[model samples]
Target chain A: MATAATSDIKWWAGGRSPFNMEYGKLMMWYFLMSDAFTFGAFLISYGTIRFSQNYWPDPNHVFNAFPFAGHANLPLAFVSLMTFILIISSVTMVLAVHAGHHMDRKGVIKWMIWTIVGGIAFLSCQAWEWTHLITGHHPVLIDGVVQEIGTTVSRNPWGPDVTGMMHDGMQVTKTGPVAFGGYFFGITGFHGFHVLSGVVINIIMLIMTLNGTFDRRGHYQMIEKAGLYWHFVDLVWVFVFLCFYLI
Target chain B: MQHSSNTHSPEVTFHHAPGDSASTIKKIVRTTVILSVITLIELALGFGIYMLHKNPDPSHALILFIKGVIVILSLLKAFYIVGVFMHLGDEVKNMIMTIVVPLMLFIWFIAAFLWDGNAWRNLRNTDAGHRPAKQEQVTKPVDAKKPGGIE
Candidate 1:
């Protein structure tokens, strides 16, 4: 016969947390799970469209611009920076959670600020990339004639790079798959929204910590829950980076 | 499981070694290094694909293989993030499974959607009435007279 401490603990006793988890943390985990599906649907639909197309734009060929490099090609460089920012932010968040575990209020505030800065940095980079794509003058050969067009959801300047025409030393390509821009902007934009909300959440948590909310409660469980959401945002970025920038 | 000092408090925290901040920091540092190294390798693979595209006749299979490798590496990075950074690994087994099992549906989701997309591609390519001349599957109409501008 199992003892009351081990296998005999009544899971449905209604008083104890049967899973040995805080209900708040459990709900946060569930919320993240559902968010995962949202991103999953976006990425999968992107893949579906990509598979149906005979010619798709190579991300490297499209995303090879640096901020101040003046048309110098740097494939995967900017997005790599974005990825590191997110990863490092996730680390700081973990540290914040760790510090919260010890009730180290100063440490939590410090790390939370850094994480917020990182989130803003990522958003700024996204803004620049989006601006570059939308307003940036890209020449493409729509039909048999060359046309100056920037990438839009309905039009992608990069088609099959067959006609080796050059305008001002820049390669003029064909109209690539229109859906490419749609999926790229749609998924990344959605993820950016998540990051935006995450930053907001972290700020609120930071304020609560400053006011000693956890101190009054005697546990930093709120920070822990927020950390899960922050890390989930970073997690989704890993895939978004994969789907849009890398492959 | 009931070994924690606080009995009335329902929050179940994993055991932390008292006065062991250094060791915990060390673990965080190690995981950070692991994550960075994996990302670097992924970027290297991405560059390799880019370099291959420069070739006049790049092997398609090789590119696909590299892409496959990148996806797997992404999954590995995801694992470390959720496990170490998010602290999911420290949670109980059934708790982990609850978060994980629903995700398995993605396998079927990706497979089915991609399968149908490929089928659509095939239908357009092989169907006589709908097929564009040769392999030029221009689903969008070519409005040549409409000047190039943002839609």
Candidate 2:
């Protein structure tokens, strides 16, 4: 019955859409929507494995180190800084899009440069973190022997000391379960790849802007599309931060 | 330089002018400031909880409440980014729903998977038919090492 009454609305009558969006932009939105699901699945699996364990490593212990802090016990401070950088980059991307809307070519270029710099800064920070995690901190004396601890698919230094019985007077520290490090590397590595690709795309867009390709077309729809992709990347990081760092 | 050859070209239509209004610029600045402030608050709350909590191992309820708050705040940031930065807020209702309604399935998928995975874990641990000897061997060492047992 309600459907019959709604037939009077001309836009719903379906000859043309009232949503004034281009075909390309709408398609990009649909693509991002699907990509979001891929990230969602990764995070959900991480949560499942983490909660099912008897003793999961606490996030505070795992992510305490920050750049130049010299091993200060700052829980999640580095990631919080990363989050701020990504958000600021998103802001710059949007400002570029806004400038595009106004046909301000120089504004677009400037803001896009800032966005690219932000992406590079973020990637460098991630590199530092990965280096620190892979190499690990100072060695600890376990059962009368100094053992160097680090992160790997099978073990991590953060969790309970899973060192098993000494064989021939050699101590064996078992560390955490295999799944913890596996998920940590897999999820964050995937996200880092996304950031890398976003940087490359932004560079291409920046070059085209300089050459006046968009100006010749008399529209900056390309910039808008790039902004959508950049913002989606930022959105995914928000959830990743919660899954890996906070929860 | 090619005006003579381009004289017959069709006139191009532009969607926006060469510059934005002052009010539009102001709005952009305001949104940026708001986003930065929210992020700062989230950082403060997270570190504050860890620093101020009396117990080294906080109560389960307390941790759960703090986790809930953090999740809500992060979602708020997502909302602002999608709505303002992506320009979806000004879009028509039908267009907005086209992106939003389908995404709800993502949350549903996560919830369903977590529940099923938890059940599998429980079954694997308790049901002898599922694991029998292997499960016993794997859990025995860890169970023995748990607190309140001989270290």
Predicted model with the maximum TM-score: 1
lDDT of 1 by residue, B32-91 (tens): 999999999999999999999999899999999999999999999999999988888866
Interface RMSD of each: 3.8, 8.3
**Candidate 1, residue A98: how far the Cα is off, in Å:** 0.3
Per-residue lDDT over A1-247 for candidate 1, one digit per residue giving the tens place of the 0 to 100 score: 1123446656657766666688888999999999999999999999998888788888998898889988888999999999999999999999999898777999999999999999999999999999999878777876778778888899888787656578877788878889988888988999999999999999999999999988888778899899999999999999998888888
State the lDDT at A164 in candidate 1: 59
**Residue-level lDDT tens digits of model 2 in A1-247:** 2223433546544444456456677788989898888888888888888766666777776788998888588898899889889988998898898888777899999999999999999999999888888887434445567576688776565545445644435344445666878888888888989899999999999999999998897767889899999999998998888787777
Q: Lowest-lDDT window of 10 residues in candidate 1 chain B?
A: B10-19
Interface RMSD of 1: 3.8
* C-alpha TM-scores of all predictions: 0.90, 0.80
| B1-151 per-residue lDDT for model 2 (tens digits) | 2222112222211112223467677877788788788777767766756664547676778777877888898899899889888878866568899989998897788778778777767765786435546444445444656787766
Clashes of 2: 1
Candidate 2 Cα outliers beyond 4 Å, as residue runs: A1-18, A137-146, A161-174, B1-20, B52-54, B124-151
In model 1, the clashing pairs are A159-A176
Candidate 1 residue A138 Cα shift, in angstroms, is: 1.3
